[model samples]
Target: MPPSRNYMTERLPSPQLLLRINTLRDRALAADSLNALAFSMANDAYSLLQYHQALVLALQGEQAELLCVSGLAKPAEDSPYLVWLKRAGRWLNQQLDGNQPVWLARADLDPPADINDGWAEWWPAGLWCVPLHNRAGQRLGLVLFLLDAPPPAPLPELLSSLWQTWSYCWQALDSKRRLPRWNASRSKLLIGLGVLLLLLLIPVRQTVLAPAEIVSREAQIISSPIDGVIKQMHVRPNQQVETGSLLFTLDETTLRNRAEVLSKGVAVADAELLAASQRAFDNPQSKGELTLLNGRAQQSRAELAAVKAQLARTQVHAPKAGIAVYSDPNDWLGKPVSTGERILQVADPAQPAMRIQLAVADAIALEPGAKVTLFLTAYPLTPLHGEVLETSYQAHPSDEGVSSYRLLASIEGEPENARLGLHGTAKLYGERVLLGYYLLRRPLAAVRAWTGW
Candidate 1:
């Protein structure tokens, strides 16, 4: 005998099962909403199949939603089974294998494969997966029938027919209430076309964007030679001063007093030595005292000369002709600074370069002579072009506390208005790439980081 005949003869649906399926079909036809339709269908399947749970899942975009659940303790949306159901539904919808419904039993599936094993813990013994479709033969959704015992031989064929009838009823009712819409196939095709157009037409630049500031190439820093308070500032900030001009001066009162004290000590020691020398001529015993006094006088003279040199150094002078680059001289006035502390910088206005701080997340492989374009905050309309001079190998924290790599770029041509300390945005260009890759590069990198790929 043929398999179909043998299956039907062995396990035909009981009269009660037939009656329940008829009732379910009538209810599905009369269902007002998609939710009501799914619930009625699941209820009928649970009653006839003697299943522990029955779930109806519908696919929307990249996700699947639990439309209705029967034999569940709580609402379908709040059930733990909902999570697994949605996950399983997505995979099932994407499957390209044969469309035949699956009847899985624990005995038959000793070592379950694919999605069957995933839900094995919950279903444990046996279950049936019935795929539903619309009139156009497009996959609409799936109906999951989970049972504690293995189903009858003909149960798969019967349940498949019943689920098909339920789908037809849902379609008839839904069509009357709603207008026609594109199926999954049509929507996917449209999206593919849109993506293709974007890839062909869109122009995306592979760039490393960073915060840049105008810096002087031949900048000379003026540091505090000695720890002292500033008494007076001679040149104003950004002022063009010649070499040897007094840039600033420290309070010389203490230094002068120290010098004076040293000088007095030196004079006294010299007088003592002269007296000792005269005594040595009269008494030979004074010769040892004369040597001691002479040594003391030389030490005092050396100390005094050193104090005088320090006193002269109290007045700081400009090293070379350049503009004084400082914010406010008043802030530095009376401020006691430590030795080697930066007081100010003298930068040549003629030589300017762009200093870029590239964020760690935004860093890319950079090489010397790579093109860089800077859009100054001051001059938004104008863009100054440059080329990369060098990039720091190590990453360090920026003033904002974000780790970043430093890049130095030499401006191609001098922009007349660009000045030192001008802030701007810099775009460092790298190798050309497809528009799709350029757009998805960061997002893909983030995904890779999250997944530890």
Candidate 2:
């Protein structure tokens, strides 16, 4: 019907060719399934190893191991790699004690030459050891993986992502274990003993007396004297300055000009005085002229001196040695300033002091020269010795609706670095009451006031 197809143009496949394609397809499918299974197993093993590593590290143990289904032999004890592992174990222990994560790299591992010889060809060169922590966050052991050469690439990625699961599992196991229970019991027992000791020592503290701190005068705010364009600023914010030292200079062009004019006027006045005296000696009638010249010379000299004195005020000098604190300029630059506009403040570091606002009732009990302890927020450990220098007699209403008196205290032996405006607590040592009263006074007062009891 198709005009008979030519034998040379048509072709047919032999049965052997069909069989070969089917066989190749079967092999490919099998290989894929095997790879997937191997990857899954590797991931599981890695997770377990990580957990064990963490446990050993937390315990400060010198050894850790990750056992697998393959029944790999333990590393040789004498091997350098083994030594490295021991070091890592020690590091892990330290980290755990410090409550930090145990992170060890391939460089941390000491391996036997032959140990990796078998797997060297199959695995990456550099391996990492990750510690696994139990539910109690205790080190379990380690998870090992070859970083340089990963198996199938995807396997390593999968293992790394799933490694956290091992930590969770181990942590659960630790929680269910008996070791934690024993530790907790021991801790409670120690706490109970401590409480008993504290109760017994209460009376002993009453017998011993400590040197009382004396409250001193509060620091005063040092304000700037003059305002002008700050030509030369010598000190920075909080920089210590000395008395008579140059703090800064104002634009003194106007003053400099006045000084120059006064200097010329003084020279002219001196010549006129000399000439007038010579003429008075030469002629009797010149006496009147000489007297007039003398008066004019004296007036010119006085004016010149006054102008020079005014010029000296242009250079800003420190009034006292202290720290320099700059005030906000408020967008003013080279602008003229009022007579008392502050440019900077110098706080005396050596004479550190603090001001406290106390309730009027508390202030009534506080007397001048009373001892007090100052505890700055910045230096909580170091209590500053202080004495009550002064207390305001008048009670003023505070923003908090409380009538308070300002109490000034001079801090003794302050550190060189202490700055102004540092907030601190001042504990005033009121008249020495019974040791028992001193200890419970604050709490009792608060309770009495709160409960109206």
Candidate 3:
């Protein structure tokens, strides 16, 4: 006889694992209290396996009642750690049904905010869960081992054996048990489902809110007609003005000085040509000098006329009768501007329209003639209605650096009430869509981006 042929002993793992399992099992049996045993099982199991943390939850009344966590003697019931752990345990219970161990990852849960998106921050990348079953084959509790690295090849099987034995002892020590599942009335369940379906199917308008401002369709933009420094602003911002009303002026000192210098040069050339003509009547050599002097006189006069033209352009004026729209006059004062650089807009107050900046992230399918409602920031209660008059095919960066599409909408009623450059939030309505799609559109898009499916 060879050591009495113990089949159970031979079926056990290597000696190292066997010794570790036996050690944890002895500790579980040695506990004198339920809390002590729970702590031992929650913490002491780490000596036999490699894991960063552990969570032990007991099944109570169809809910996972968290008993203890590794490395903590006692944690408050309402602590954030325990709250999130309980949610994880409930999700694990649903995942586990048979008397076996399972590996779970973030992808399996598709965690919501309640479960917290920062799963990896609190837990480890590698997760192993053991669903503890009673001798009657009913799920009694759960054990979670979080690992930062890969587990040993024999880790799961050995841990399973040790967990099964400890769990059996734990159930014998504790009095609470899992409640059996209940079946509700079929009529009531069906009615609730029908109501939920009807609610989800309700039609709702697809809407996107974007930053908007009251703009003019036919406004004349007053720009710097020449490259010069802004000298004066004749009309205040949003001030009423008639056609040819002075709006602003550039620095005319430089142009005026240049014109004066050229005018004097023309006078000098005329004097020189007249002297050359008087000398030409006396000597032939003076005749040649007269032609050159006459050419210089004509060139100087042409330059003087050009300088006067620039001096006239320094004073910008309103092209059409309307309100002047621009930033603070102080900001533009002493500011050098290039020719054709926009300084202000002369917009017709009676023909105000909405200019919406729809961000790329919030952009929806929009076309001309779409319905729009603008709620001014100052007067949010009274909304101005409009229809989309034009939409840009491409996206351009807004002042805030957000890429957005430009939309022009016509104000239907009380256009006179809407002032040019007034800021507001525009709600652009699209074709009617199901309520379910309207609500879940963003969430589904996020999930699809995450899963690439």
TM-score of every prediction relative to native? 0.58, 0.39, 0.59
- Per-residue C-alpha lDDT of model 2 across residues 19-91, encoded as one tens digit per residue: 5444433333343332222233334343323322111222335654423212223336666555555554454
Q: Could you give candidate 1's per-residue lDDT for residues 1-453 as a string of tens digits?
A: 699898986566688776766777777777788777887867766656777878787755668777777854346465566666667677656652546677656576434264565676676576677777788876667777787765766556665666777778666665676777756687899999998977755675579778999988889999888878899889898999889999998888888898889889999999999888898888999899987898899999999998888778888899899999988988999999888889889899898999999999998778999999999999989999989998999999999999999999998776885788899899899877778778788999999999999
Itemize residue pairs with steric clashes in candidate 1.
none
- Location of the lowest summed lDDT over 10 successive residues in candidate 3: 173-182
Assess the local accuracy of residue 287 in candidate 2 as a C-alpha lDDT between 0 and 100. 76
Q: Identify the runs in model 2 with alpha carbons over 4 angstroms from their true place.
A: 1-232, 267-284, 319-321, 325-347, 359-362, 369-375, 378-385, 395-404, 410-419, 427-453
| All candidates in order of lDDT, best leading | 3, 1, 2
lDDT per model vs. reference: 0.80, 0.54, 0.83
Quick one: best lDDT, which candidate?
3
Ranking by TM-score: 3, 1, 2
lDDT of 2: 0.54
- The TM-score that candidate 1 achieves is 0.58
Across residues 307-386, which tens digit of lDDT does each residue of candidate 3 receive? Answer: 99998888777778998888899999999999889898888888889999999888878889899999998888889998
Clashing pairs in 3: none
Off by over 4 Å in 3: 1-204, 415-417, 434-437, 443-453
Instruction: For residue 51, give model 2's deviation from the true position in Å.
Output: 67
